[model samples]
Structure formats: structure tokens, C-alpha cells
Target: MALIRFVLQSVVEILVLPVTILSYIGIWDPLYKRFFPYLMVKITSAINDKLGKIKKELFDKLPDFASSSGLSILEVGCGSGANFQYYPWGCKVICTDPNPNFERFLKKSIAQNEHVKIARFIVASGEDLSQVASGSVDAVVCTLVLCTVQDIDMVVKEALRVLRPGGAFFFIEHVVADKTTWLHFFQHVIQPAWRYFGDGCCVTRDTWKNLEKANFSELNLKHIIAPFKWSLISCHIIGYGIK
Candidate 1:
């Protein structure tokens, strides 16, 4: 039984290797955007609703220096501009995504919101946000994005650079399971295949460790497991830090 299982797993991994490689190179991004953008938007909106209260709570914790009015805010990987509705009023919002195809969705979404009418769109990656001034932004927000970036460290560095002194970096991301040995086993076993079809998202990344290494002076951590599931796959950590 063990031998058969091992053989099947190896075959699945091998079959998925090419797709994984292509995803890393961004081949599937356009295809997915073109064919499945509506589905993607629905899923993202649902998840955002599920996490809305938590987002509001985190926002309330921001330092006084972080302004909801006339303050500059940059959101990396701002897919379809799903976050615009959640942004506080009177803020200057800049939404960026490496995929230019997301612009249409962003425009449509922003059109419905008077508060976000002034929101600017940038075609850039998290690793290279040169258009944004260093130390000018009061807050940097990223949600469900770290797992998909190719260079996580570079993105973190960029976040730190753009944020003003005492600024906050807020993120809510699904991370690898910290408990459940069996789930960890499954994550390892299926990661290669998952990467192939899921836009290079890793189910198990030490995201908090990355934040710590980024050297934020004050770190606030919150771990929330999905309701009714102890499985690591559904667990998420939401927190922020000050520079």
C-alpha cells in the first residue's frame, strides 16, 4: 500500500511540474484572468466579507500617525481593487497589481464607490514600487498576497521602504498549518501540484518569520483558525507592525 501511494504521489508531482514552472513565470495569470476573472472576484469578495470585522479591528489599532483622511495608502497586489470599499474615507489610495489585465476589474469596481473615485492605479509589482515615494506612505496594506509573490523578501523590503517612520504594515494572509502533523504531511505532499494550479500560492509559508526578519520594531500578531476546522490549510494570521 505504501509503495503504491508513493508511486501515485510521485506521478502527480511529476505531471504538475511543468504547470508549476509556467505559473511561476506568469504564463497562467492572463489565462486565468481572461477566463475566470468573475469567479475570482466572487471568491475574493466572499473571503473579504468573512474577514471584514477583523480588518476593521486591525485598522482601529493603527497609530494616530496613520490617517484615514488625506493619508497616502498603498496596497500591493490589489487584485480587482476589491479592497477599495473597505478603505477609510478621505484617504488617498494607490492600488497596484503586476497584472495589467486586472485594470478593467479595478475600474469597474472603483466606479461604484465615490470615496475611491480618486484612487490611483499602478501597474507594478510589489518588489518594484518605484513610482511610490519612499517614506511618504502612512500605511501599507496587503491581504492574501504574500504567498503569491516570487520574491517575498523583496516585497517586504519595499513595504518597509515606502512606509513613513512609525508607519504600519497591515496584512492578513493564510499561512501553513502550525499544528496537525497530518495536515503538514498533506501540505508537503500536495504543494507541488497546488502550485501548478493555484497561482504559485504556497499553503505553508512562515509569513510571520518573514515579518520578524523585516525588522518591524513593534509587532502585533493574531492567529485565527477557520471556524470548525483545525486544519492548517484554513488557518490565517492577521497582524501589523510599525516601522
Candidate 2:
């Protein structure tokens, strides 16, 4: 079973490795940018179908201040704007990502989800969001992002910095499996290749532990298995933290 899993993973990664290399080198940006987002949309759509209930539970907690015109949300690593459909109606969202390639796909998502207003789409990573002012947004969101960020602590800090007092930071991430599990062993074995070919995603990150120490005024976190049969990335953590 382990050998079979390794073989399948290698095949998939081999298909994506060239695109990853070319994308970083700035060759065929248009082609790769389009292809990558298309792949992500399909993957996220499947995941969303399973996590609909969990997402509804978390997003419903986004505070609605009577003084403000509408909720302002900043989504870090907002790839293809997958969470746009989950935002409250009429709320304004500021999307930021290091990969500028996602901008076109984001516009398409915004058009489809017309009720959610897109304030702007900036090409910035989660670690350095200096472009956004401190205490500017009512909420900060990151879905499937922490696994790939260069510095998880810095990203969490930046999310807190951008959020207004009492604002929330929402997240959904697949994390390291339980230490005693066979899945944990698999995750460690394949982590290096996964990071190289899967856009810096680390399969065995202790994301929940990091979030616990992130200094959130309040945190409501839960671990769940996503609806992917025997999938390597099925173990997940979904929750929100109040700043």
C-alpha cells in the first residue's frame, strides 16, 4: 500500500513539477497561471462540497458592526477567490496573494458571486501585508494557506495586525496527522517531494499547535477528516480566532 501511494504521488508531482518550475522562472506565465487556477478551482470545489457545514458555521461568526457600512475582509493567499461565495452578502473583501497570476481567476469568481464586493486584489504574500493599514479590516481569512507560507508565525501576526479589535481570523487548513498514526509516517516520508512539487505545501505541519500560541484573544478550533477517501491531505483543521 505504501509503495502504491508513493508511485501515485510521484506521477502526479511529475506532471506538475515542470509547470511549477516554469512559473517561478517567469516563462509562459499566462498559460501556467490559467492552468494552475483551473486545477485549484476543481480541487477546492470538491473540498467545499464536503466542508459546507463547517464553513457556514465559521463564516457566520463574522461580526457585523452597526457603525460600519459593511464588513471589510482581508483574505491572505486568496487563490482563485474560492472563499468568495462564502462571505456575507454585500461585504467588501480585499484579496492578497504572492502569485499575481490568480488575479484574473479572482475577477471571474467575483463576477459569479456578485453579492460579495471585491475591494481590491493585491499581489502580496501573507507574511508582508504592509500595503494594508493596521486595524483596517473587520476579518482576515486564510484557507489551505498556512501549509505553504514561508513563515507561519509572521503570517498569523500580520493577520492580527490588519484586523480591528474584536475582529476574527478565519482559517481552514490540512495539517499533520496524529503522531501515532500510519498516515503520520506517510506524511513524513513524502514531505520533501511534496513541498518541491506542490507549491511549498508541507504535509506534516503542526498548524494547530502554532495557532494555539498565536495570541488570539479567543480561538475556536476543531479537527476533522475531509471527504476524500484515503487521500493524503484529508486530515484538516477548521476554525476561527478572535483578535
| Regions more than 4 Å wrong, model 2 | 1-34, 64-67
| Pairs that clash in candidate 2 | none
Q: After superposition, how far is residue 120 of candidate 1 from its true place, in Å?
A: 1.7
Candidate 2 residues 18-99, lDDT tens each? 7667767877465644567777778778878888777877787775521266789999999988887778888889999988
Q: Roughly what TM-score does model 2 have, to 2 decimal places?
A: 0.85
Against the true structure, what is each candidate's TM-score?
0.85, 0.85
lDDT of 2: 0.84
The 10 consecutive residues of candidate 1 with the worst lDDT sum are 61-70
Cα lDDT tens digits, model 1, 48-99, are 6677777777766544555554567889988887777777666677888887
Residue 139 miss distance in model 2 (angstroms):
0.5
Scored by lDDT, model 1 comes in at 0.77
Error of 1 at 164 (Å): 1.0
